[model samples]
Target: MTSLVDLLHHPLRWRITQLLIGRSLTTRELAELLPDVATTTLYRQVGVLVKAGVLMVSDEHQVRGAVERTYTLNAQAGDADNAEVDHDKLRTMFTVFVAGIGGHLDQYLTRATIDPLADGISFRQTALNLSDEEFTEFITAYGELLARYADKPDTADRTRRMLSTLIVPD
Candidate 1:
């Protein structure tokens, strides 16, 4: 079995996490939402998440002789607040995270019409100097700010956005 970080490092799995963030979804429904990805692939990745306890089986029933399942995000498994990971795994996870962001950027740029500025797209590095206490406070506050909007439902005027953060000691 892999850690939550390792399980979530893949693009599809990461997207699965995002989709399951605020609601429950079935594999068939996920396939409908993500038409580009094959259903088999989604099922396999969902199985991995379930095995790692990142996703929970919230409901299930038999459908046409097959068992259909609905899954919800396991908040505890998704939270990596105090997990102690080795340096190598951390580095690999970071690399994968950057690669996933780059892949999304590439896709966005290749689209026929892309207005990065108007779309609120941003990518930049910020250096923050703070003591341990200040850093903890800052992180907590930032998380709280995001939590306010994390579970918002999709609306006619709303668009899903990805926000990634990285903090390294200098």
Candidate 2:
């Protein structure tokens, strides 16, 4: 359990797992999708995931004396769904998740083209004061809403979007 939780501790690994959830991708494809990460580092992270059993090679073929492999995430392993997830570990996971989102947005913004509204790029913060019971209800509702459509199969008409959420009480 600890190993599973720790496997996603790295920002890159967590992002890789996120990208692989509900999808299969080759190492080269991942590198192209996440051009911000160096080619060598991306390959190393993919290897880590493969060794940890979080990701398995779904396809392999020999072409021009090179083996091309594609990977897919093990069932629910890419998600931080351990029964032993404590507050501290949860915080660590959330921190890593947020950092990865921030990094990706930062990298994307570096491109010469800038169009936040057209792309629907939005960020906002609000303070919610709720009693313990209300807070629990809020969390449950949020989780249910996210889960309802989180695993919708990727389709040509649908575009990939990143959504990260954080909840903290003062």
Clashing residue pair totals per candidate (backbone < 3 A): 0, 0
Off by over 4 Å in 2: 36-38, 78-81, 124-158, 166-170
lDDT values for all models: 0.84, 0.83
Instruction: Return the clash pairs for model 2, or none.
Output: none
Tell how far residue 64 is off in model 1, in angstroms.
Answer: 6.7
TM-score for candidate 2, please give it. 0.70
Task: Report the lDDT tens digits of candidate 1 across residue range 96-162.
Answer: 7787777668667877998989999997898998999999999999999999998798788988787
Global Cα lDDT for candidate 1: 0.84
For model 2, what is the error of residue 6's alpha carbon versus the real structure, in angstroms, after optimal superposition?
2.1
lDDT of 2 by residue, 117-168 (tens): 8877888888998999999999999989988988898899886777877777
Compared with the true structure, model 1 gives a TM-score of 0.79
Best by TM-score: 1
- The global Cα lDDT (0 to 1) of model 2 is 0.83
